[model samples]
Target: MAEITVDLIKELRERTGIGMGDCKKALVAAGGDIETAITNLRKAGMASAVKKEGRATNEGQIGFFEAKDCIALVEVNAETDFVVKNDRFQQFLTHVAEQAADTKPESLEAFLKQSYAKEKGMTVDEYRASIVQTIGENIQVKRLSIFPKKANHSYGIYTHLGGKICVVVDLEGASDEEKLAKDIAMHVAAASPLYVNAEQVPESVIEHEKEIVKSQIAGKPENVKDKIISGKIQAYCKENCLVEQPYIRDDKLTVAQFVAAKGKEEGKNLKVVSFIRWDVGQ
Candidate 1:
């Protein structure tokens, strides 16, 4: 058997544009012959898939998975909306989301190296490459996020526009109120709040808002400027903070007040801990 050296693997990778692991394996299987390895890769369609890798991937869907211990959201991108609607692409996205939820990989690179859950004898990235070859488009597992379940914490998940937009809200309370949590998640999807509350807003961000407010009220009296700035900041928080924003279902009550009212009915205290909102191509 021929020894498969680093240089040989590198040459194969340079020729194929495939992953190092795949390149090395191909080299070894071909007895360290770069031409033979390239032939094998081409026969398997991996080499051809490399041609589409550089294409723009601005259309795709978000995949959501919920497990007993954690929840996951994955954004997979493709070159066209037509590919996004393909059955195989949708299946691959679902499998990737489930993998993220099950494995809780710390990073996208780690996730790609994981074994594909629905397929045998293949890494996630390998499966993705095969899909690209089949679909004849650039496909990418863009990003993923996992949220671990916490005691006394319930999650509200809402998917909008058939997963073009997805939101997950973590709520802390004594009892699980799924409907309330989901309502908050829906509010998050619709309102697009950056923070859970006013206090969560960074001081730098507040200062920047103040600077904008000051410039807008430049001609105002000096004594009234401070009060006006304070008012403007307060309004900014109300609009940008999830809890402070008016509830989408009932504009009369702020999101925080709505949660509090629900808590009162449930005989427990409730608060929004954090949330994640994802928009496709964003």
Candidate 2:
């Protein structure tokens, strides 16, 4: 019979997040076999699985993968910052991103149901469950996206604060224009624009802002009130629209103007097609 050492008990406790005494007893019951002990703990529902499920997962790292004409971004979340730094969690996130890149699933539900190709006969959700059992935290795949290059298009990505924020941009331009795309992505990270252009701003949003601005200036003359509302709407668009916002690098120019100037310099018809930004837990 194998002797159950303290080190074995400690390892089990770390993996399962169970109490010290329970880990020791489980190890003893399994004759010091770590794998069997883990099984017993899980079967008996003494593992950290159920208790951790209801906890909010506000801490996580963004996983990313890029290939020729394709890119994927995934946000996998856990309950604590400590788990965010765990190597197993990081590895799992990387695998999730890679799977997104390969499969291009349309939605989060579909992505989880897809088989985890690296592991034999395991769905992504199953893999996620395995990770929860190992790390003893509520693990979730929050969101993911795949950006595949369209005809005559380019892509760029930027990850900030060690994946707390990520930006992906798609542009219609020459192949050598990836640097411009990357610069735009960085600007998106800083500016946090909600729409690509003034035209993309919804009519309802504009109406809502106008109502707020009108009420604030209602004491003024009727003619002046209209002008003030118009000005406020323009300012709102400038602040909220990506193309209308002032360039982060050069306040003298809007993002649209910056792209146009760069395009002229490179003799290309460059334009921003679309963009997506993700901030963890937002």
Candidate 3:
């Protein structure tokens, strides 16, 4: 057997964070080769597909950006929240967000594959690897979103806790009241709007709502079916439309009236095109 020194055990333990005894055993098994031992330990640690590097990067920060008509958000995850706040990780996230804003990739996967502008030396994954080595833990690029501009539109973006949560909104047209767009975006971050407009409500959700309404009105006579249908449709419209939502600031005027009032005052028609919201856990 090769010599198993205390130094070997300590080094392996520090590298893998596995138990000291386990690290020592791995070293001996690898015939005092630290590299071989680390590989073996890492392989054993790979309990799940994602665990190969460590774990699903359950911790990280969100990154956000906006430029006139375009906006983007990215989530860069690391093994720990401590690393999430590290200057390097934060800078990396900013770089990734900027890259996301700059690239008009046809798809999210395509976006990840694109060379990250901030890291000239490597592709996105390779940059992540460099960070992982420096940080001594697994890091992952989770997901991102990029919004394309619409004619005459402006984008509003919100970031909380350096990216614990993010929200972006696209106003179909610009207004002198730019603050309103931000307010709307903040509301989305707080309230978590699922659909931009009633028309965008998924058919599955609508059908599910209809079923629930139908069940509730089941005991009613068949003669009132039309009335029930009409009432349910009205409820659906009121519940699903962001325009009909109670204004977050005032809680009095519906979102439609809120926008309309501002539009009139500004002498512009501001329609909402779409929005995106992201939170760490979600």
TM-score of each: 0.94, 0.82, 0.75
Which digits, one per residue and each the tens of the lDDT, describe model 3 over residues 153-270?
6667787766788877777667344577778888777666678778888889878877887888888887696688768876776665676678888888877788778888878888
lDDT of 3 at 71: 71
RMSD of model 1 against the true structure: 1.7
Which residue runs does candidate 1 get wrong by more than 4 Å?
1-8
lDDT of 1 by residue, 1-282 (tens): 678988878877787788788888888888888888899999888899997898999998999999999999999999989999999999999889998998999999999988898988888988999999988999999999999989998888999998899999899985377778898999999899999988899999999999999999999998899999999999999999999998999999999899999899878899888999999998
Instruction: Supply the global lDDT for candidate 2.
Output: 0.87
* Candidate 2 per-residue C-alpha lDDT over 104-164 given as tens digits, one digit per residue, 9 for 90 to 100: 8999989988889888777787678778877888998998888887877878788999899
Candidate 2 error regions (>4 Å): 1-48
Ranking by TM-score: 1, 2, 3
Worst 10 residues of 2 by lDDT: 44-53
Q: Which candidate number maximizes lDDT?
A: 1
lDDT of each: 0.91, 0.87, 0.74
Worst 10 residues of 3 by lDDT: 43-52
What value does the lDDT take at residue 238 in candidate 2? Answer: 91
